[model samples]
Target: MDEAARLGLVERYIAAYNRFDVDGMLALLAPGIRFENHAGGQLTAQADGIDGFRQLAEHAAALFREREQRVIARRSEAGRVVVEIAYRGVLAADIADGPKAGSVLEMTGRSEFAFADGKIGLIVDRS
Candidate 1:
């Protein structure tokens, strides 16, 4: 697929994520999708297939009362579209020793996406 089309898929995924619509996000993923999340240089999450990804997305959605991610910049490389992201979310639940519920969490990150059969087959998110 072309870069624009790939970027469109990513945007739709982010929109679905912002709305906490797990189904909507899953609809754009390939059946064999692979997803990974890295925070502070540590591997924080991973899901190997669509089913696994759905579970991960659902769980994540439940943790945020409200969230948004905007694509601030983008570049295409080696069949992947990498985009700089700005993220902001209000926590819905507190962690044992982490930020409390209702606290606003903000961060800058980047997502790399690879498409297959017009759907996202791989996604790596780092922040």
Candidate 2:
């Protein structure tokens, strides 16, 4: 994808995440997309298709009560887009399971997204 298209996809993806629009976010991902959440202790999610993505999204919803993505910076080099995102949210009560109950946490992270065929292929997040 061109730089504009790549950046647009990234922006849209972030917007959907901020809105907690799982379906919308999934729409922007490739069938076999893979995302790595470094801050989440290096958790990796692979969406082989929309169904897989939906499942992941559902899990995400269960884990986070609220999620906000603040763009710190963005740049495109070659065919990859790197985004600096500040994340803040509360962990979902059910997902936290214990110590995190009623706890709100804030974190900052940088993610590098590589787009292919107008869909996200790889997302490496370093928080």
Candidate 3:
């Protein structure tokens, strides 16, 4: 896809994510989509294919009462789109040893997007 179309697709995914709309987000993903989440230089979670991603997305929706991922910038790099993001979230439930409910989580992250047939195929998120 062209750069504009690619960016639009990614933006749509982000919009769905902020809305916690799993199906909306899934619609923009390729059937064989791969998702990876990284934190503190460690791989935290991942899902392969639409079914796996859907489960992950649904579970995540319950963790955050509110969340936003604003695009800071985006650029084409080596046949992929790299997006700089500013993220904020308010937890809806507490983890055993993690942040408490109602706590604000803030971070800056970047995501690398790989497209397959005009849909998002691979997403590698780092924070």
Candidate 4:
């Protein structure tokens, strides 16, 4: 896809994620997409292929009642799109790893997207 199209796709993906629309998010990915999630400067989770991505999304949605990602900055370059993100969510369950239930969680993060065959092939996220 062209740069504008690619960036538009990324925007759609982020919107889907915020809406907790797993299928919508998967529609923008390549069949064999790979995703890595990093937090606290360490690799925290990974999902391969569409099905694996579905599982990951569902798991995350279960923890947050309402999650939103605001794109602070985004740019597409060198076959990848990098986005600086501000995330906010309402905790739906006690986070054994981070916060308590009923708490409002906020964080700053970045996601780098790589494309292949005009679809997202890999996504690496850091926070």
Instruction: Kindly give the stretch of ten consecutive residues in candidate 2 with the minimal lDDT sum.
Output: 93-102
Candidate 4's clash total is: 0
Overall local distance difference test of candidate 3: 0.95
Lowest lDDT block of 10, candidate 3: 74-83
Candidate 1, 17-117: lDDT as tens digits: 88888999989999999999999999999999999998898888889899999889999998898999999999999977899999999999999999899
Write the residue-wise lDDT of candidate 2 on 1-127 in tens digits: 6788889999999999889999899889887777766655665554555677688778877777787989999998778999888888888764434547456768788989987677987777787
Q: What lDDT does each candidate get?
A: 0.93, 0.80, 0.95, 0.93
TM-scores for all predictions = 0.96, 0.84, 0.97, 0.95
Model 2, global lDDT: 0.80
How badly does each model clash, as a count of residue pairs?
A: 0, 0, 0, 0
Candidate 4, poorest ten consecutive residues by summed lDDT: 94-103
Candidate 1, residue 27: lDDT: 93
Question: Can you give the lDDT of residue 47 in candidate 2?
Answer: 52
lDDT of 3 at 16: 96
Compute the lDDT of residue 7 as modeled in candidate 2: 90
lDDT of 1 at 43: 94
Q: How does model 3 score by TM-score? A: 0.97
lDDT of 2 at 61: 73
